[model samples]
Target: MATDSAAWICAALLAFLPLSTARAAPLAPGQPAPDFALRDQHGQVQRLADQRGHWVVLYFYPKDDTPGCTREACRFRDDLHALLALGAVVLGVSLDDSDSHARFAAKHQLPFPLLADPGGNTARAYASLWSLGPIKFAKRRSFLIDPAGRLARIYRKVAPDRHSQEIIADLRALQQGHAPRP
Candidate 1:
């Protein structure tokens, strides 16, 4: 009877599994990024328009201090020098409030700025907002924008362990006038 009940539960879960959909968010490469003005942890404004002439690495994460998010942020912090040397400026965005962001930044010793997207409006504009595991907020997404503001690459399935290395590699290739490999 227990075996039968377990099988029934498995079958029910399989029946409710998500079907593959073609309506996923559109790929945004080669298009100009939408400009934004958001406040950072320090309560100062960060305007995308003001960064027009610099290569921008804009990463949207789910939260401030969760495990996976922390790993990703630390990786970014570790590789910050290489990123800046490649002429890229990194910015992190999440639905975390400024106070939370301040704590996360100070705790992690992050060298770059983190933008606070408390209302989720910025995440929605970038199609990076989602809910998971009872937490309603932004999803983990990263975009590499060129100096002229064209979206050069989007990393949706980023591995927190090696994400910074991957971004650094891509930036190096871009600097060398070569297209990055998949």
Candidate 2:
């Protein structure tokens, strides 16, 4: 009975720990964003190094067309022009393959590149990969990389419906040489 009671206490303590604590610490502001070369939906390679001198919104999603992922993608799609006007380029990352990304992009008419991270390397580098048993998925997270390739901000818990607008507001503030809102 004592052994069982101890085990239950351990389990309860573990359950209270935030999932983020189980993974690596996310890339914080002022850290250099990790460079990656992954194939986009169009089968062309996209590299982070190539995006230098432009603000890059690197967002990771769990699945290609799931409800939350779809909402996030469509939100980005709806705000593409405004993002572009701010000189920001949005690139989405997922553990799904290129074929899946292509279908998702087409279904939503997404104007941005959805990069495929089949091996989850980029996702892991960004501390956005979630694994359970034999399945792996990318967490819903976003990194704002500035022109110098440094992380401007990191959004660990993203609300899909409002994330695009949030980023846009941040970009506007950042571009005007003001600190972004918390």
Top TM-score: which candidate number? 2
- Whole-model lDDT, model 2: 0.91
lDDT of each: 0.85, 0.91
Error of 2 at 114 (Å): 0.5
lDDT of 2 at 21: 19
* N/CA/C clash count, model 1: 0
- Candidate 1 lDDT, tens digit per residue, 1-182? 99999999988876676532213347578988878898888999999888888899999988889999999999999888888888889999998888899999999898788999877777877878775323457778899999999899989788989988998888888888899877
TM-score of each: 0.84, 0.87
Off by over 4 Å in 1: 1-25, 132-135
Give a tens-digit lDDT track for model 2, residues 1-182: 99999999988876765444126555679999999999999999999999999999999999998999999999999999999998899999999999999999998899899999988889989998887545688989999999999999899889999999999999989999999977
lDDT of 2 at 84: 93
Which residue window of length 10 is worst by lDDT in model 1? 18-27
- Whole-model lDDT for model 1 versus the true structure? 0.85
lDDT of 1 at 165: 93
